[model samples]
Target: MLVGPRPLTFVAVALAAAIVVNSEAASAQPDAGTSQAAKDAARELATKGIELYHKGRFAEALEQIQQAEERYAAPTHRVYIARCLVGLGRLVEAKAMYERLGSEPRPREMAPAVRDAYGAAATELTALEARIPKVAIAIVGASTGAELSIDGNPRPLPAGPIDVDPGSHVVVVTNGERRAERRFSAVEGAKVEVRLELAEAVQEEEQGSLVPAIVLFSVGGAATVVGAVTGGLSLAKVSELEERCVDGHCPASDQDEADFAEALGTTSTVTFAVAGAAVVTGIVLAVVRPGGSSANTGAAATSAKSIVIDPVVAPGFIGVRGRF
Candidate 1:
């Protein structure tokens, strides 16, 4: 909201007076390529902005004035911009613009209307310089290498009391894993200390379902059971070898059986390890949600995400398959 309904009424009146320039001056583009049509459009916009300002619509008025400035160049436009900022409670910016226009050199033959606008700017400067609020923004619990900003502009850490307009604003602090924000308001001649803390840990909420984990563990258990049963059958071959290899001597027939027993032992060891790893992985998916994808959770997470894991086992080999 604009402060005090008619806070910058005198300057608003100057806006009405400034646009009374002749066609040649009004058509002067800010850059080389702007057409006369654009200059005319800009004038229309500026006129609209001025009317809006008179009605206490500072935001709408500022929008129009900005568009006009972009299309055509004019020293008088600065006058309206400064006043709009003042009405919008952005006194710091208004004061700076006013100071700049006051010190800027101009021709003796300049239009009287423009001259009056500059005069108004100079007068405004004197009154606003002392009323700008000061804010001492502080950050707490922010991670190393975290960044802080005010209204989207980055600020150095420990940046002491800064000049601000008397209005509402938001300060933000962010690290890769956590973020925090603080909103505050300021009044003329007031000093404020504001703190933004990034102490909340950013965690992904569980999304999707437990179906994937359940399937993975079930397949892993099945593989383990198959490996165990095969190993038990190999015990019969082991006992026969023990009888045949008496006195540390065995026939060639025993070699094939011994080889079969060793194969069973290898399969048991591999399948058991693979099964344990699968179970552990499944448990992890069930417990911890990834910020981006795992068991998707939070506002952005979608139920349509797909994940599958299955353990494969055969008589002589074992493997796994999954899509994430």
Candidate 2:
């Protein structure tokens, strides 16, 4: 006889449930052999690292622990690795590892060790950072061929990484008719990068106004012309006195002529002095005027370009020396 359909359906449902249960059981079984093998390898590496540490081979110990740490995923293994790094004076790497492991909640029994390791690593890191040298400076602006200055003294441009005493300093930058200034600090050997934008206008002003030179020349030239005229009038008076003295006259008239001659002589001496002063003034004006002479023009241009005034230091504190 043929089996009934209801019986067939029930048998199918029982088979499906059995298959599902078997699959769950298989998945739940731990691969004890694989896990044990991994643990054994990690332990072996850690033991080798410890032996190296005992032998005073700190570098090798660090290498072995690092390898085991990479291979093992356990928090306990990682702590050991951090400790080895600390022993090797690799404080930065040790600090990183300890910080990572310390963030996780450890078992109550292991919490104290973890906290201690973390604290020690942090302390070591702090000490290392303090011992290292560091420098911090703001480069406000620079021209293509600009030079740097420290505390108003000319320093080489594009300064090589500088090691400086730990403190703040005044820094200045200079280019043709452009300048910039800022404060900076350095500590031992650390490099501090600071970027400051220099206002183009302010730099131009720091180079100083060109108007002063022009004013000086103008005033000097005017004074020179006035002196020349006064000198000529005095010279003419002396010549007239001599002519009168040469003409025949009575003793009284002659005496008056003699007096006039003395006065004229005095006037001539004054004229000569005035004339010398005028000539000197004119020469100075000519030399100082823009584009007047090759030497003077070059000097004036250089002065204008590299000028910087330190108003805070003193009234006469002028930092004029610079490299081209």
> Clash pairs of candidate 2?
133-188, 133-189, 133-190, 134-187, 134-189, 134-190, 135-190
**Per-residue lDDT over 60-98 for candidate 2, one digit per residue giving the tens place of the 0 to 100 score:** 877776675554444434555665665654544665775
Model 2, position 113, has a per-residue lDDT of: 28
Model 2 error, position 226 (Å): 72
Candidate 1's C-alpha runs over 4 A off are 1-44, 139-146, 174-181, 195-324
Assess each prediction's global lDDT (C-alpha) against the native: 0.70, 0.49
For candidate 1, write residues 50-82 as lDDT tens digits: 778778798999899889888776666777788
Give the C-alpha miss distance for residue 320 in model 1, angstroms. 28
What TM-score would you give candidate 2 relative to the actual structure?
Answer: 0.30
Top-scoring candidate (lDDT): 1
Estimate the TM-score of every prediction.
0.48, 0.30
> Ten-residue segment with the worst summed lDDT in candidate 2?
310-319
